[model samples]
Target: MLDSFSFFNIIEQFIIGYFLTINTVYLALVVGALIYVRKQMLHPSVVKADALFKTELFKSISILVPAYNEADNIVESVESLLKLEYPEYHIIVVNDGSTDDTLQRLIEHFNLTETDIYFEEQIEHEQIRTIYRSPDTAMLTVIDKKNGGKADALNAGINIADTDLVCSIDADSILEQNVLKKLIQTFIEHKNTIAAGGVVRVINGCEIENREIDKIHVPKNFWARLQSAEYIRAFLFGRVGWDYFKSLLIVSGAFGIFDRQAVIKVGGYLTNTVGEDIELIVRLHSYHLRNNEDYQIRFLPEPICWTEVPTDYKSLRNQRNRWHRGLADSLWRHKYMLFNPSYKHIGMFVMPFFLIFELLGPIVNILSYIYLIVVISLPTYFNLTFILLFLAVSIIYGMVLSLIAILAEEIVFKTYDDFKDIAILSLFSFLENLGYRQIHAWWQFKGLIDFFKGKKSWGKMVRKGFKE
Candidate 1:
């Protein structure tokens, strides 16, 4: 029989090995993203919005906003979308039976009146209650539908959209003026590009004027500040690295552009899954690969879209839970793609990485922490020096990865102008690993449990709206 010391030694070695492997993968991703981002900086795609606006080179797009109890921010969000510097596009707002005054607010603010329009039902959706249009602004339209979830609401908008491309955005998000222009440039540059996503920065502390982001800064709230760093790390390294490998699985539902015909061909978003965005992208990749057709789904570092992140712990926890659950749902729904060479890198690399590292990462992290505590508490099995060394190395390595992500952000898009803001963000990047990361792991673990229990509902998120 193995003694406690030997048993713990074996467990410790395994845990350390696992940590090293995950960190090594992260380091590789950081290197890959840095290279890609550097190349982009050197040969930057010059976006001439004036020329694109004057010419017919850009395809027409329809912006879809699905609102469920978004009365506070609906008007501002719609106003922001109206000001997009794109030549040919219209806005479609779907009010998914909000108990709040979301629909009423739109009707009153936009001068919306009942209008009759015919649209092909390309995807399954709930019954439409009414369709409204604004006489003052010919570009705005609203659809009142039954209490269907976000996916169903988006499908309704997809069916109603009469444009070459469709852009899906949350009702609380604010897009930069030239966002569409930049996205359209990508579509024009790459004819095979069927879908693309933009970066979504937290707007909690941003200065807004006339429904537009006037200035950007890190949030005052500690939790929000931590989330700001998290977003920067995720977008700067995670998505960018995945894009570098050509195995990107998710284009955030907050702000993503898609080819209309391609989406229709794939049967649109999966209504039953919590992760409709990922499911749709995976299905698109699978469909195109199986059919032997050319297609490209990309993540663009530019073209910023600012959104309101949850400020409180409860809201943030709920949001993280839903996200993890969604990830599990999406991955399991497409399990056949795992290690299948026919789907190329997406199947062999992306799917496996997400399944092992992303989906099961929380469980491993929590278990390792618990085991470390247990070993440390037991004097017979305790190795104080080993525990201290292991924790110090783990934390320092995490801090280094966060710093690299921050460096990537600074190098590519210098969105934050203030040196003070940069310094503060850097500080939070290091601090996030201390306690926030463990809390995040716990939230994700709860999500995994909920997924196993067949929970499909998205928990409530209380939004305070963007600071005006």
Candidate 2:
């Protein structure tokens, strides 16, 4: 019995309601993140990198580099790892059967010689062809294995790791010299700390020399710049806020430190999902809670890793598609944790939030856009003033959140040194809400569709190696 006007009105109200709920949650997260970051800023002595390095309390770490067709950047990335300031840590690189000359390049550059090593098969992975260790340094080891996905490669590295802590990083990433020192300080401070993740910055335009980051600059490419803004917002508020609630779900695979024993205890990484990083963290939470064990997984804002981001739209779309699909797969795989009070905040709050907002947000956003266009185009269905007001409020609220994230970045890390760079980033923060957001939402929508279609392949991610 509803008329056309009534139907449109109901749709508009529903959209508004959805927007209100999502934005309200974001606002609360922003506030929580700001307070937590402010407190950390005031107490700078909580984890002193310098002091930790001088003391004997520093834990040994194993850096795991899983490379797939990374012939171009493998050498430089390994050299960078060799230069880390940590006192006790070794680098392990797993070559997952690359078609390129990745294994040969590592052998030639590092003078790696095949060696016999025995390791416990804690996790199932692809067959290992052979293991190589550097005779010159003795600190570096490389595993040549058959073609398996990234998760499988990581599991291979974890099997060979002898250290107390395992640090996972992308083959293309460049870690700061003191990154390990800073991350280990947390594990020392909190005995129950099982996992900790750091901020990952875009390295597209940064100046590098001798495998070290000499200077940081905003990327010249428009898409890369938009992603820079996105990273700042996500790392600054998203992870930090979740850390405050003790329900942190994701620790970026780009740079995350984990207790080796704990990871082994939880069965290591699942080889089937592309979002193996998030899946591992969620499982850790569930495992610890179910066992009634005291544990903490943290997201540190200080430790930084610089990595390349997609500059072209095609590459960006592929990357987002893979990421969104991974998110969907992980959530679906662990659906039992949703609203199960026995798991506490993680089960009742974080899991449900990711399901309602993170995974399905793109669908709602795309539908809202279609509805808006249809309503605006059809004169009989349109209510111009109401539509305009609704859009203005929605856009403004998003802009405000973006601005707050920017402010949080400036206050805490201030990674972008130049005032002009900050200004450009601020401008992009506003601009992103306009066109870029929609495009990103579309990519995620496509990802969800692909997920439902039972597609599991990871589309190609073309990376222009970091400047050196």
Candidate 3:
């Protein structure tokens, strides 16, 4: 019906519109995050650590660490958790049938002994082999159970945690000394707060001293460097922006604090889904909104959790693939919330945004890439203007978003002190959009395929442990 150029012109317009639309939303999110962070910083509720100890807002919490064959970092991670500045909180480690000497290491290191502590099993989970507690530490508890997934392990930890709030973290992650103080402040300030997530920075390039991150710098490994930028953009703008609208959907599983009873009411994390973090959060929203209960799920920009990110190609691919599949799985599991006015902004705007922009984003991106290649191969359609416009909208704009995220991190927390590391991050921010982004899109597309094909495996994740 139309000539080659004319047909391509329509496609080009659609592509540019899509890019501009998404990027513009991204830009708005950054702006919104900036405003929200500034407001939170100046808010009167910002309490000092010592002052916070005496306040009525102090709530006892349980730190739940689900470890599976995390022998290399288990000791170090637990030692760091002991150093956290929370006034009163217990550490509950669930060793989910780790073949490695993960449980043995804890027993030897912390003098863990079998305890006959009883707890109500509010949620369904596999049978526990034993429960161990350390008399010396008086705060650490370990649960040995059959090999269920992370969700099942967390549910086991939840049953034993009698505290009002529970903090879920990866076994390899090192929390900032006062992270609990910062995260708990949310619940203290707002009684209606149901759950909240903190920022998780890459720990690859950091220097570890006595199981604590002594210094922070951009990751040295190539893959880790790119992911570092990706993490910055994701936390600073993506989650923060969503928080501004009170429509935040995801509170990263790596580091999030939740109300204990609320989680139990929602039946804890779903054992079947690899995306238990998002699934639980989405369910929380659905449960609260449908029941006409006023609640808030927040994303806090302060409290930092330095975590180990995948450093190699295979590991990184596996991680992203699982993440995309998780997104798809979460969205599908709660499809009832899509475009339903009964759920308010969460159903109307948040769900649709995730569906079109996040869930199917990779598909749209890959299709555009294919169209570009086909057009460029045909000599008759070799128009420089068209190619430039596409690159400008797609590639260059992404780089800008990354740079803004880095600068925003600097402006907010000044996490990276070395200017050279900042420069390196900036370089990778530009470089990632060139080839890496397209490849990432392909990986996510494959994940979508895997979801439909009913792939349930978490794939092998090999960690090189934290660098010195």
lDDT of 1 by residue, 206-286 (tens): 899999999899999898999999998888788877788787899999999999999999999988878888889999999
**Per-prediction TM-score to the true structure, in the order listed:** 0.96, 0.96, 0.97
Model 1: how far is 42 from its true place, Å?
2.5
Query: lDDT score of model 2?
Result: 0.89
Off by over 4 Å in 3: 1-6, 44-50
TM-score of 2: 0.96
Q: Which candidate, 1 or 3, would have the higher lDDT against the true structure? A: 3
Single out the weakest 10-residue window by summed lDDT for candidate 2.
Answer: 44-53
**Consecutive 10-residue window with the lowest summed lDDT within model 3:** 43-52
- Where is model 2 more than 4 Å wrong at Cα? 45-47
378 Cα displacement, candidate 3 (Å): 1.8
Residue range 1-468, candidate 3, lDDT tens digits: 898668778888998899889888998998899899888778633365457678655899999999999999999999999999888999999999999999999999999999898889999899999999888999999999999989999999999999999999999899999888888887887899999998889999899988888888888799999999988999978899989989899999899999999999999999888799999999999999999998999998888898999888998899899999999999999999999999989899899999998999999999999988987898877867878888988999888988988887887778888899999999998988988999999999999999999998898888887655
- Worst 10-residue lDDT window, candidate 1: 44-53
Candidate maximizing lDDT: 3
